[model samples]
Target: MNSLKHHILSGLFMWVLSMQAQQRPNILWINADDLGLELGCYGNLDLKTPNIDRLAKQGVLYKRAYATAPICSASRSSMITGMYPTSVNSQDHRTINMTPLPDGIEPITTYFRRAGYFCSNGNSHNMSRGGKGDFNFLAENIFDGTDWRQRKEGQPFFAQVQIHEPHRDFVKDKEHPISADKVTLPACYPNHPLLRADWAMYLESVQACDKQVGIILDRLEKDGLAENTIVFFFGDNGRPHLRDKQFLYEGGLQVPLIVRYPDHFKSKVIEKELVSLIDVSATSLELVEIKLPNYLQGNIFLGKKASKREFVYGFRDRAGDAVENMRSICNGRYKLIWNRTPDRPWMQLSSYKKAQYPAFSLYNVLYKKGELAAPFNQFMVATKPEIELFDLKKDPLEFNNLADSKKYQKIKEQLFQEISTQMVAFEKNRIPEGEKTIEKAKASSLKYYVEKIKTHNPLFTADTTDEELLKDWENRLLKK
Candidate 1:
């Protein structure tokens, strides 16, 4: 009779554990590559993103969401680990040698899996090959499978769906093509016909990405998981454009963020608080009733007890062959950028920029001809200011420079001190990769770009100056 009682008690305990697992909300992260605040929900009426707009209406929309890093690998590394990329020596884009994460620190998936959550990562369109995990740290056993459907019966899940759209090689939406005439170009960029057409193509790609989001949401509802799933849709970084993807400017750092959880988070709420992409990690763990690890730098920005950040920081390290070290701090109203390597030109010799960005050639040609405008021309200079201060409230496009202005000296100094303090803290726990590794990476990147340029642009010659080559490309683009 004692043995029978033991068996019955064990069965009841197992049943209780199963019920707890089922009660936990399934987390779904839809990460869009190189997308920005151009969605219909973000007040860009020129773009048609019906699905994303509907998602915003169903939940909360963040207006001032920013990524920790402008580049993918660094940004994603922070997002996954809930730690600053600088702290983990993951600041550089595509590090030569990936390092294992710190002893106590692990990917968020590890925590989810420990709590009986089935973790899956896969491309939104294809589930066979898995999704983009461009993390600088070595990640093994991060996910149990490529799709959540493979999980056991009644098991909760943490799934990431990578949507690679609107990055580059912009895929035109044949079904609904956007007109160049209707698009509004940024004042920083030259208002040329070719640029307008390019912008339209980018919008088309964004529209296509919206369709993909709709498909995923529809599937969730069709499978009866939408009601219980917590959905997060956001970009990995800023939009893929000249001076946008690799820089610390708002064009690169700012991204669209939308969250939906039925009966948990309030619907139709527009959150204007400064939120970092890394916060998603902490928020997800909190919503699932998991204790946030002490080492996590991300703040919980969702529940009733959500905290708002006073300042959002961004970092930019070496991107491909071009080496740079820049840091930015924004306190909603003002922003400060500290450039470590001020000697390097803003338009450095980056092969990816030369080939992928048509505007690169156009800018070079226009600058050489003395046709580029004031603030735009500033970027073409051989050297940049070591410090740049901008009043974001007065200058949304970041055209004015107030670093040297005596009136703003107090504000600038305060920001400088805050950033300095933060950097010192980050440096305390940083893992250095040594100078030799960085040099090797620089050499490899340079070699790759040289070979690519020669193979593709036959007109490009060793003797051809930048101005000459750019002029030729510009003429061809205009003609088209």
Candidate 2:
């Protein structure tokens, strides 16, 4: 009688484990490159994004979502680690072979993998992307394949699909390209024909990305995974434009975030609380009843009992060879920026950026002729103040500087202290590397990349005779 009872208890324990495994929902994260909050659902009427709008209608849309870092690889690194980039020493804009993530830190996907989720880091539609990870640290065995089709039978999944659109070198498609005349220009940009054309091309790229999102959603439905999968759509960073992509201003960090899971979340709701991209991993784990580790800094924002965030932080460091260091703190209405290297010009030399946009080239002409207008000319100043304070509620474009205002002293002091405390906790050092070290890092990166490319293409040979080609390659490596 005792043996029979013990056997029955063992069977019941296995049955409970199977039920828990079946209850976990699949997670799908779609991250777009350099896309700002310009979607139709985000109050930008000039752009056409029907698919994303429908997703918003069926999900929760966040109005105040931001990336911890504004650049590509840095932001992605922070996101995957669920911590601030500065904390992990990954805030530099360009990283070569690998970044030294902190000893205890690991990619958030590793935890999901241990929990029996079949993870992937590519499109669900099986699109080819040349297999470029582009992340700061190594990613091995974290992602099983490019799509969910490679997952074991009856296993839950966590997939990420990255859409490269609205970034610099915008796509120009034949299918109803955006009209230059109809595009609405930002107040900080000059209204030139060339600038308008650039804006139109960016909007066109957004449309193409929207269509791609539709394809991914359709694929989920066809695969019968929509009901059990939670979909998150957001931009990896901000828009690729002057004073946007690489800067600490609103355009540089603010991104559109939408989360959809019909079974456990409310539909057609708009959240106005501050949310950071770092919260994504924690939120996903919460959906499956997993407790976030104590080391994670992000809070869960998807569940019914979500709490509001008091402040969101942003960091910038060593963008290309420019050697910039800055930090910012925002409370959704006011923003405070501390420019560590105030003497450095905002428009530092970046071959990667200057080649794509008319900011530097045309700004020189406009400044010489005194044709540049307000807000547009502000960014062209040779030097900036050590500190900048802006009431975002009033100056959405971040035009007027209120750091020196006596009336706002209390507010400014509060934010400054908060940011300083956080920075100390993270052990963030704002000192730029020495000139020799910066040059060494650049040369080492160039050698590694040149050799890696040659390894992939055995027939290719470096042109020793062409000085321009070597220079261009070095510049690209610096911009990598």
Candidate 3:
């Protein structure tokens, strides 16, 4: 009876297709959680994402796409409202779970829904912002596993389908068939069996999401809504893990993005343009020939494209029961990091918490002794230098610190200036800089996410057992 009712409803709604007003094209956005460019199209050597790769062949694949915030909620929020995290007064990831939102940070769907487009989010409404949760426009549930083709013809629609796979549960490092053995891992972490197994599961999730993408595309074609629909597929942020999820590294912020509009766009292109998830607003809005809002901070990456950015910015406000505050600015050539807590370091938010995970403990030992691999030691364990500048051209892994080098003085000066300017702008948009200092980073992290995570710190080691201490730098440093 329920299935009959749905079919009857679908047939009745299909009748609405006869009358075609000057309505906008349908919008379908499929986003993955904690995903990067890990498909065949995005250069994931481990797996074959035939569907995602097919979409790339049919559309334009972005080379340098980025998430506005490395953390999920912040990036997701920015994409919805088309604004920077700081602009929304959401610069600090800690406040996401703490403070109430400022005005006008609501979902743009409210605006689109008001404009007569049927808006729905299938399944995962994994949004981090917008206090209004009561606005349900669907007849019953937007999360009924329906894609854009499921809608009635001639009725303009906007559908968002999200996938939350390959997240946290990959902790055991269990193998998932397809793997990342060829994919390089940072040196701060050691190569281990458990880690490999965990990564394989992560790959399996990507492949699984890819399979779902195939289903949606097939439906779009079967329903004959192919040409009129604009499809955008991407990740909410970089992968969810230690350095990637909570920290502002490329592995965290950089993601694969693709846009497809059959009737429009002439080029099957590869744009190395630096773009953030916030700019996704521009692409969506422009496809419908609508003017972007003035307040949106991101530049339009397509449709009368402008000069691409030199260096985009990323932030790490909080994650995994801890707040690891940081601000980073990256150009294709260089990157500069502003660690909010520059003094006290090495608070394990991921590996240490799960001490059984050797990646964390193993690196802990090497990092403390300043003996980790090139970029791992440079990026993961190099105690916060307050301001870190690296020539990305020379150090793609971001393993070098050129802040003190005179050889790259000009590059350093330019980056420093650019970062400073960005900081001021961010400050203006941020909560007032009160008397907060990094005096007790560890304590502050524990206090902030005290409720979210269980206590999972490493076993304290004695100074005399430095050799067998696993990776206890704090013991050696403070003689603990």
Candidate 4:
């Protein structure tokens, strides 16, 4: 009889554990690469993103969401680890030698797997493969399977769907082609016909991405998992454009964030509070009733008990062939950017930009002809200012610089002090990767860009002047 009682009690415990797992909400993260705040939901009237607009109406939309880093690898590293990339020595884009995460630091998937959640990382359309992690650190065993369908019966899941769209080599949207005339180009970029066409193509890529979002959401509802699942849709960084992707300007760091969980979060809410992309990991863990680790720098930014951030910080280091260090701090109203390497030009030698960005080429041509003016010409200078301050409320495009103005000196000094303090704190936990390692990486990147330029555009010879290059590019790029 005692033996029978023991068996019954063991069965009861197992049943209770399974029930607890079933009660937990499944977490779905739809991370879009090189996307920004150009969706229909974000008030861009030119773009047609019906699916994403509907999602925004059904959930909370964040207007002031910012990325911790402007580039992919560094921002992704921060997202997975819930820590600043600088702290883990993952600040550089595509580090030369990948290293294991520091002691006691692990990807968020580690915590989820420990609590009986099935972790998955996959492409938006297919769950089997083709997901982009691009983490600077060595991430092994971070996911159990590529799809949530592979999990056992009644098991909750943490799935990340990587949507690679809108990141250069943009395919024409044959179904819903956007007109160049309807698109509005940023003020900093020259208003040329080729640049307008490029902007329109980017919008088309965004529309295609919206279709992928609909597919993922539809599958969730069809499987009857939408109700018990928490959905987060956001970008890995800013949009893929000149003066956008690799820079620390507003266009580079600002991204759209939409969260949907009907049970816990209110619907149709527009959250204007400053939110860091890293907060996604912390908020997801909190919603699933997991205790946040003490070492995590990300704070929960959802639900009623959400923690509000006073300032959102960003860092840029070694993007492509350009080796530079820049930092920014924004308090929702004001922003300040500090360039450690002020001698480097904003238009540094980046082969990827030269090949992929038509507007970049146009800017070069226009600058040589002395057609570029004011704010647009600033980018073509030989060196950048050591410090830049802008009141976002007055100058959203960051065209006006107030760093040296007497009236704004107090505000500038305060922000400078805050950033200095934070940088010092970050240095305390920074990993030392040695100067030799960085030099080796820089050399390799420089060599690749120089070779790429020569091969991709043979007309760009040492003797080819700016005028000759412009005519050649226009003839090649402006063809129907």
- For each candidate in the order shown, give its overall lDDT on alpha carbons: 0.86, 0.78, 0.62, 0.85
RMSDs, each prediction? 2.7, 6.0, 8.5, 2.9
Candidates ranked by lDDT: 1, 4, 2, 3
What's the lDDT of the predicted structure labeled candidate 3? 0.62
1 against 3, candidate with superior lDDT: 1
User: Each model's TM-score, in the order given?
Assistant: 0.93, 0.87, 0.76, 0.92
Q: What tens digits encode model 2's per-residue C-alpha lDDT throughout 1-480?
A: 999999999899866765676679999998888999899998999878999999999888999999998888879877887888777767776654344566777788878876777778784234553222456565566577878767877788888887877676678767776777888998778887667777887888888889889999988899999999999999988999878988899999999999999766777656569999989878888887766777888888877547778899998887665678899999988999999899988976654554455555567567768987876888778998999999998999888999999999999999999998899976452234567767766565455535544543444333322233333333432232
- Write out the backbone clash pairs for model 4: none
* Decoy 1 TM-score against native: 0.93
Model 1 lDDT per residue over 133-216, tens place: 899888688889888888999999999999999787788899998888889887767788868877888899999999999988
Point out where model 4 deviates above 4 Å.
Answer: 1-15, 431-477
> For residues 1-480, could you state the per-residue lDDT of candidate 4 as single tens digits?
999999999999877877887889999999989998999999899889999998898889999999999999999999999988887778889887777888888899988987779999888867798488899888678888877888999999999999888777676789999888878887767788887878888899999899999999998899999999999999999999998999988889999899998766777655568999989999999889877888888889886558899999999988766788899999999999999899999998765676567666677888888988777888899998899999999899888899999999999999999999999976565564457876787677656655655664765544444455456556654667
List the lowest-lDDT window of 10 residues for candidate 2: 461-470
Q: Say what the RMSD of model 2 is.
A: 6.0
- Model with the higher lDDT, candidate 3 or 4: 4
The Cα error of candidate 3 at residue 173, in Å, is: 13
Best by TM-score: 1
Model 3 TM-score is 0.76
